[model samples]
Target: MGRKVCQQDHGQSRQNSNGHSNDHLFSTHVQAVIVQLSRPVLRPGFRPDARLWRGGIEGNFEVTISMYDASVGLFVPYLRNLSALLDKGVAYAEARKFNPAVLLGMRMAPDMYDLAQQIGEACRHATVAAALLADREPVALPVLEHDMAGLQARIATSIEFIESLPRAEINAAAERNVFFRLKNGTELPFTGRTLLLTFSVPQFFFHVTTAYDLLRHAGVELVKKDYLGRR
Candidate 1:
């Protein structure tokens, strides 16, 4: 007798060689498995079906991570940590007998955005991505205020907006098409997943990290934990 493995087909089950029904296997989650056998059962152009599986003898399995988990799960914490990070900037300014607003003008390079702009971009990326995925208009950028409190308020507004989006709507947008328009009036097209993963998240983090670096370079004391927050 040949060794038999379980396969799922539209919720129906068949018995294996051991006379046990295989319906229970992979019934609970989305997964892809590549079994290691004498012969490769995964053929060329093999794709995950409705069940998200390709079967053969003993193989490897892949799990589907959700879009919601990838997007909001990341943006919220980092935005919160970003807010906390700015608070440290305020403290550093106070202790050194300088205006906290001074730090917002610091940047690593002359061509780059200063600390205030970086924070604004970070908040913009987070909120825009969430709004796009939720099928809503993104929050408009307010007039740039030169104060630390103003920047902090921007972060607060972003957090509130991102948290207000429905998780289900965002999750369902994984395959939806969205266009990103650049300042030059060029529109770039992307699916929701690609927009968030490839563009939005990366852009968001770049500005956030730049903001952190600006403060550190300006003599504000910050550790990695300040960036990561309580994990």
Candidate 2:
């Protein structure tokens, strides 16, 4: 017997080809979620919502621009952690009758930067990242922070520096070319988007995580929650 019948969707499986492809609908929905959460594209003036794109796309330049802010945003927590942990670490060392300087100077590897340098580098990256993203001149890296108080001040200063920029200036940088010198003393230019996603953001996190690792390796009682400051 030859037959054709409309089947109602009960939400059991994603595939429904009777009238429309539920499989396609579900697949597109998942892809959109991934883009919004992780892999956002940088397209100036391109709206992210479904109403505008009409293809279930889920992000825009604004979302990508927000990454710069979020890059700085993540540093906020890093700074706070460093502040609290530095105090706690000092106390821990005092309790054990060990000089805190030894712990502060320790690194997971001999070839790597020490805790003070790690914290300084993290702050420096944040400062430079915000300036480049906003298309402004970077503030000169402050004199290297030595003590815990100096480190905390450096972090706070970086945050203040980033927050001082106008959002419009940062957003306007989507099309701007940002020139930066490589370690080899040669300059490499990048569009603001590439600079953030490829260079600044990664460098910021690398130092942050390294700072965290330095603290944890030195036996500071910092859990993962300490790494990611909560709301």
Give the Cα lDDT of each candidate: 0.77, 0.66
Worst 10 residues of 1 by lDDT: 29-38
Off by over 4 Å in 1: 1-62
Writing each residue's lDDT as its tens digit, candidate 1 over 28-114 gives 332333322223347886543432233422233433456766887788889999999999999988998998998888878899998
- Lowest summed lDDT window (length 10), candidate 2: 56-65
Clash numbers, per candidate: 5, 0
Angstrom error at residue 20, model 1:
35
Candidate that scores best on lDDT? 1
Cα deviation at 185, candidate 2, in Å, is 3.4
lDDT computed for candidate 2: 0.66
Residue 200 accuracy (lDDT) in model 2: 74
